[model samples]
Target chain A: MKTRIDQCLERLRKTRRKAFIAYITAGDPGMAETVDSVVQLAGAGADIVELGVPFSDPLADGRVNQDAATRALAAGATWGRLLKCIEQIRRKSPIPLILYSYLNPLISRGFEKTARQATAAGADGFLIVDLPAEEMEPYSRILGRVGLNNICLVTPTSPSARIRKIAGLASGFVYCVSREGVTGMQKQLASSALGLIRRTRRWTRLPIALGFGISTPEQARAAAREADVVVVGSAIVNRFAAAPKTAAGRKAAAQWTARLVRAVKEV
Target chain B: MPRKRIDTEPDAHGHFGPYGGMFVPETLMAPLQDLEREFRAARRDPSFRRDVEYYLREYVGRPTPLYFAERMTRELGGPRIYLKREDLCHTGAHKINNCIGQCLLARRMGKKRVIAETGAGQHGVATATCAALFGMQCVVYMGKVDMERQALNVFRMRSLGAEVVPVTAGQQTLKEAISEAMRDWVTNVRTTHYVLGTAYGAHPYPVMVRTFQSVIGREARRQILKQEGRLPSALVACVGGGSNAIGLFYPFLQDRGVEMIGVEAGGLGIRSGKHAARFADGRVGVLQGTRTWVLQDSEGQIRLTHSVSAGLDYAAVGPEHALLRDLKRADYSHVTDREAVDAFYTLARWEGILGALESVHAVAWLMKNARRWGKKDLILVNLSGRGDKDVQQVSAWSAKHGGPKA
Candidate 1:
């Protein structure tokens, strides 16, 4: 089966507009809301949905995303529960799902087991938040063997020479961190990401997705104009915090996710 | 597999057994690739070691003396105590021992700048010293809280032409400072070297740091043989990221007669969960780059750690210690906040040596356990840093506790 990363990119290029990639932390409040949010993202025009695996110390994340992860983890989010959410999301949503996590959880789960499980759970790829490209051999091999795309990250700080190296190794799409800090709602994407995206284009035909600090629809729309996929994460997770503690709260969160997807997909 | 070691290889993906591996985010891949290649080449070059060794001895004052703590040992009423006097080294700590070595490598690599994270501010002071010595631009990131507590050191860094950036995020502690430093390294890998404070982080770092710090053990081993004609019965030091302990323990690790013990800060109390006792609570995991004992939740999120000493307030131990623990090569324990405070006073009054709270934990351990060993039994503790900087904090804390009036 063609991985969701591949399909999403293919559809995105044909559409002329950008791929709407929405992000939500797993088990934010509870697992049901998380799963519902994923499906809602798909229904609301998100070409792909990134599911953040909560970790205690998200060194790469900004304040907003970090707080979201803490909230999710405190609510009893576990690897098993996250996997179950992915499985449930796959039952309804055909949009590609990427498991965004730090290297520690995968190490504990055993990379091979995580790869196989992620693939089986209908995860098209993994965006290892901490597994930089130089150390990609073991993870990429496992991901390739399991038919899962091992997504790589390229940052605005990445030099031209390194950009070529990252684009070559990247599967799915390259996650271009628009800023030096972790994922959060930024006032704007870094001006350097555009140059990075252009440099990355010289190396690979693969889609380049802009993330980290892309929160507002205008920012997403601006970022979308420059890249194949515009990725938003902390914004979706933040919405759940404001929702009520009930079934309607979860649906409301799902609706919020859908709205984000629609906003990003707007031409 | 019974897991023969405390650390594993493939770098969590599968590289060195415990002490070597890479654990960074995907965004850092390209830079790390460049670093790994350069490091592999640097390690193989004989001149690299020669230059590092020369600077370590001449610049940072290597072969730091191991002085027998005659007064404190007699008062403690048991084993003879010796101090690996890193406090007497340039800049007043063992931190410069590694900084000098790393700075030389950075120069050789043609790097133009140095960046470092400071907890107690010792390492930042050390890094700034080296950067100034090398004529390189230096930036030091320290938690805002630490900058306040260690204002003198902050001023010292600025005097050495280093920019001290105060990190205000999160708990405003060492962990956040490290996070900010790593981000800076990733962003400026082309021209900057991150002078990591401890023997932790990704592959090569744990190994490189230990290698640089090995002089502590080498000198102590030689001094003991020349002075007392035999090895000590016990070796002790505080464990923040376990570098100082590793530095002192490396040469003695294979010697069965020498007992190696690491003391972690049992801040206030272990049960309070506000201590930097990684061995007591941390499990084997990867953070930054290497597999080590880390105090993290089930989801592998790094937790906020606490300690009276900024240097000891780390959430992970060096990978070598993790391996040593698994192999049963060392005994790791903790001393309570009250006990450490008591030891601090004892050192000042009995020995006239003011000790860092991080180092006080080791003193506390020796004081608490001196009676258990025979009179002839010798114990050596790595006094990793001096306490001159902590005088104010200690005085204030003592006043609050109703001790000798501040």
Candidate 2:
């Protein structure tokens, strides 16, 4: 059976439109609101919804995502609660859901067990930020057995040879880090992103998604020009963080995500 | 599977039994691989060894005296205690030994910049000192809380021309500083070398750091033989990231007659959930880059750790220490913060030595357990650093807790 991620990208390919992926930490405001946010993002034209599993040490993340994680943890989001949250979202929406997390949480649950449990909870794939391609083969194989895609990351600093190797192993799509720094919103997208996407095209036929520092609608449209998917994480999460426990904050987050998705779709 | 001997460590992939694997991001893989290769080649080069020796002897003041603490030994009324005076090193800590070695490697690798993370600022000062000596650009990431607690060392690092970046992430402690340092290294891997502070992290780092710090044990082995015509009955050292303890324990691992013990920080007490005792409270998990013992919650989030000494305030211990603990080659224990403070004052009055609070953990262990051993037994403790940097904080703590006076 084709994974939800595979079907989503294939459908987007036929329309000749870039995919709009939205990211939100699973327990940022609260677990119940997390379920609402994923369904709202899908309704707002998000092709794929990424739910960040809060980790204490998010080395590759900047202040926005870091604060979201801190809030999520403060709200008592455990691994089991996060899985249950995904199940709740699965019942409400058909959007492709990916578990975005650092390596420790998944490793603690055992890779095979996490893959099976996540598949059962309606997660289509995983994008572990700190699991390098060198150590990804066993995990990829384990997830593949359960028909789950193991998304891989390619950075601006990645050499061509390394990029080719990562592309070969990547199942769903390649996550292209648009800049040198950690995940955060920037006023403008890095100019080097286009060249990186072009170089990555030479390696794999899989779709490429550009993320990290893509904040504004103008930046989203610019990123959509060179990639198959545009991911807006910090921009949407920042809206929720601004006013954590209010309906107004959730409404702002939905509106902001819709605006970014519209910008990507417009291109 | 039977436990392997101590010599055949960290197979090609850098696993010490089930611990010690590269868990860094993709951007750091190439740099770590490059460092591993360079370290293997440099280990065999006589010129590299000669240069490290020269710096250790002349610049950092090595071959530190192994003086017998006559008064403390008499007070303890059992084991004769000897202090390995790493406190006499140029930067007042054993951290300089590893920094000098890493700086030499960084120079050899043609890297123009070095970055590191420090908890108590001793390692930061050491790295900055070596960077200044080698004429390289240096940046040290320290936690904001630690910077406030160790203001003198912060001033020393800045005075040596190193940029000190205060990390305010995740409780603003050593673990957060390390994460920030790793982020910096990933961003600038081509032109920078991360001079890791302890005998932790991924493959070559644990091995490379252990090799550089082996000088402590080598000298201690020779000195004990020269002074008393035999090796000491036991060796003890504080285990903050296990660098200094491993340095003194590695050479004596083969001697079945010599007992080795590593003391961890017991902040308030282990039951208080406010301590840095990894073996006592931590389980097997990954942190930084290596899979070692870490204090983590049931959901696998790294736990908040506490210790009076900033240097010992970390959630994980080195992978080698984990292996040693499993193999029963060395025993591990913890000393409470109050006991360590008392030992700090005792060393000051008895030997005119104001020991770093981190090192006082080891001294505290010796003071408590020495009476159990025979009167003829001899014990050696690694005095990791001087207490001048910790004086202000200790005095403030003393004023509140009625500890030692200034």
Candidate 3:
């Protein structure tokens, strides 16, 4: 059975259109408005919306995304409550959803419970940053029971043989990390980004999504040339991090982020 | 319980009975693999072994004497105790032994830049000193709060030509500094080698650090055999991340009758929920990188742990220690903040040795427990660091926790 993530990536590939994967903390400015922001991002043309379930120690993220997560958690984000937010978003939008997280939060809540709850909440998939495929078995087995894909991330530093192994283990689509580093905005895309995408292409027929250090629209459009999906994480989160806590303010932030998402969809 | 396999435990992937593995991002996987390959090759390389020995002797100073604490033994009136004087090492701690070896490995790997995360600044100072001697660029990440407390070591690290970055993330201590240093390594993996402070973290690190730190146990074994004519009844050391404890215990693991005890920080008390006692308060969870017993809240967030000693204030123990604890091969215990402080002064008064508060946890354990043993019952405590950097901390700790009296 194809999950929502698989469906979205397949649909995008069939349409000959690149997908824009906009990222944001599940409840950045306010928890009440997470459903609203995700809805607004979908309306703006995001093919897939990846929600970050805030963690206390987000070592894989740079300063901007880390602060965004801190703000989200301060506003009352939890594994249980964030799943509730996902259910709320599922009510208002059909946009494919992916929850970005670390291993601690899920392991703390018990993987089977979290995976079952996420599936019930209509969360499409997950990309646990710190959980390398080597330790994915126990969690993957639990996730597989609920029909969800645990996204595999391939970095520029990944050797060719491991790249093939990772791609073989991948389910929905492969996430190609454009550069070596935590998630953040960079002035330019790394020169090695294109090479990593080319290497990943040889191993899978699945759509390839590029992330990490891709903040600007120009970088996103350039990434879209060879990549099947372009992910904008810290870039979008940086927008709403300072937005006013009102619904209208968050809506405006979502619209501003949508413009970045929309520009890539035209690619 | 399984018999001690020593070096054979970690098994190819660095897992010690499900306690350790590479749990980092995909970006770090290749670098960790490269590090593991280079580390394994370096172990077999004669020049690499020669370089490490030369640095240990001429650069860091090795074969530190294992002295008999006659006064403390007399005071206890029952057991015989020996102090493996790691405090006398250059940079004032056993931390330098691993730093010198890792810095040399970094150079051999063709990496020109080295980075490390420090808690109480002991590791930071040692890393800075090695980087200076090796002429490699060094950056040390220290928590903002630790910088304020261990300000003396901060100055020492800076004076030795290393940039000490202040990490303000989460609890702003050792673990956060590690997270930030990981970020730096992820960004610059091509040219940077993260000189992890202790025997923890992902694959190769636990193996790499323990191998580097095993010198303490190696030296203690030879010294004790020559001085006492046999192995001590037990090997003891403070287990923050268990580097020093593992260092002193690894060489003696094969001795069937030689017991090993790792002392953790009891802080106020284990009941107070303000301690760094992972075995007492923690459950199986993943933190920073490795899978181990972690001091985490009910929601799985790594808890902010407290201890009088800054160095022993971390929330996790080494993965190998976790395996040993489960096997009952080594015993784990804790001493309260008050008890450790008193032991700090107790050692200073009796043996005229101002031991680091972290080291005194083991001494405090021996003081309270060793009295039950007879005069021939030997206990060797790893006094891992000198207390010069901690004098200011202990003085302030005295004013608040009451006088440091036995």
Candidate 4:
């Protein structure tokens, strides 16, 4: 049986429409709000939902996502709680969910056990920000055994050889970083991103998802034109963090996500 | 039965047993691989070795005296104590040894810029000094709290033509500073070499730093043999990331007669949850690009660590130390903040040798265990740095907590 992520991307390819992946820190504001936001994001046309597991030292994240993680961690987010939130979301919706995390938490739990538990909890895959392609062999084996995807990342600095290696290991999609820095919303997409997408296409048949620094609808539209999917994180996370408690804030977040989804789908 | 030899370790993948692997982001993988290639090539080149040796001999002042602490030995009247005076190095600490070597590597690699992260500012100052000497651009990331506490060293770093960037994230400490440095390296990997300050981090780093710092052990070994006609009974050094301790311990690992002790910082006490004793309180986990013993909560979030000495205020130890502890080759212990302070005063008063607060942890351990050794036994300690930069902080701490009675 195909995984939910693979099926979602395959279906999107057939429709000639790009996938819109939305990222938010789990347990931000609170767990209940996290569940509500994921459902709202899916309702707003997010083909895949990326739930960030909050870590104290999020080196790859910019100020916006970092603050979101800090808030979630402060609100008592744990690995167990994140899984529970996933279970809650699974009950309500069949959205393809990816657990985005740093490597320590998974290493602490033992990779095989974490992968098994996450698979059982209905998570489709994982995106470990710090696990380099070179060190992903054991993790890939564990994830493969559990029939889950281990999403691999490609960067602007990634050489062609490295890109091919990562592409070979990637299961669901290749995350192409739009810029060289951490995750954040930028006013303009990086000029080098187009070249990266073109280079990555030569190596993998899997869908390419461009993320990092993609914020505006125009940027999302442009990214959708070049890649199979576009991931918008910091902008959506910034909305919920600005006013975590109020209904109006969540409505604004959902509205912005829908706008991004609409722009990507139009491409 | 003979003990196993400790020379052939870390293997090819940088694993000291189950610990130590390159646990960095994909962005850093290419750079780390490039660094490893350059480092391996440089190690085999005689010219590179010559350049490092020249800098060590002239610029950084190597072969620092290994002195017999006659007064302390007489006072203790149990074990004869000697001091390896890394405090006499040009930058006032042993951090210069690794910095000079890395700076030389950067120059040889044709990199124009070097970046580093520092905790107590010793590594920052050393990197800045080397950069000035080599005419390379240097940038240092330091925690805001550390910058305030080690303001003198901050000024020293800036005066040496280094840009000091204060990191204000996650309790504003060494771990945060390192994260910031890693970010900078990722963004500027094309023209920069990260001068990681300790014997930690990715594969080539721990090995490279240890190779550069093993000069301390080599010198101490020759000096002790020349003076006492034999190896010392014990070798001790404070283990903050384990560079100094590893430097002193690496050469003597094969000597079954020498007992190596690594002293970690016990802020309040181990049970108090306010300490940097990774082996005692930390579990095996990956952080800052290597799998080592790290202080973390149940959910695997890195914990905020505490130590009177900023240099030792880190959550993780070097991976080699973890392996050593697990193999039972070296014993690990910790001294409380109060005990370290008392040792600082004791060394200053009795021997007229002021040491960094980080190094005093080793001295504190010796003082506590003095009665266990015979009068004929000899102990060697790595006095890792001078206390000039610490006098202000130490005085303020003393005023608030009342001076140690010792």
Please list all clashing residue pairs in model 3, or write none if there are none.
none
Q: Compose the digit string of candidate 1's lDDT tens values, residues B58-112.
A: 8777778888899988888898999989898899999998898888878888998
Q: Candidate 3 DockQ category?
A: high
TM-score top scorer: 3
TM-score of chain B of 4: 0.98
DockQ per candidate: 0.38, 0.62, 0.85, 0.71
Q: What TM-score against the true fold does each predicted structure earn?
A: 0.83, 0.95, 0.98, 0.97
For model 3, residues B81-168, the per-residue Cα lDDT tens digits are: 9999999999999999999989999999899999999998999999999999989999999999999999999999999999999999
Ranking by TM-score: 3, 4, 2, 1
Worst 10 contiguous positions by lDDT, candidate 4 chain B: B3-12
Give the lowest summed-lDDT range of ten residues in model 1 chain A.
Answer: A256-265
Which digits, one per residue and each the tens of the lDDT, describe model 1 over residues A109-205?
5789877888888888888877766667777888889999878887766777777887877888887888665567768678987887888888888
Q: Model 4: clashing residue pairs?
A: none
Report i-RMS for every model.
3.3, 1.5, 0.9, 1.2
lDDT of 4 by residue, A166-236 (tens): 99998999999887878887789999899999999999999999999888899999999999999999999
Q: Residues B74-134, candidate 2, lDDT per residue (tens digit)?
A: 8889988999999999999999999999999999999999999999999999999999999
Task: Give native contacts recovered, as a fraction, per prediction.
Answer: 0.47, 0.54, 0.86, 0.62
Which residue ranges in model 3 land beyond 4 Å of their true spot? B1-8
Cα displacement (Å) at residue A252, model 4: 1.1
**B221 in model 4: Cα distance from truth in Å?**
1.0
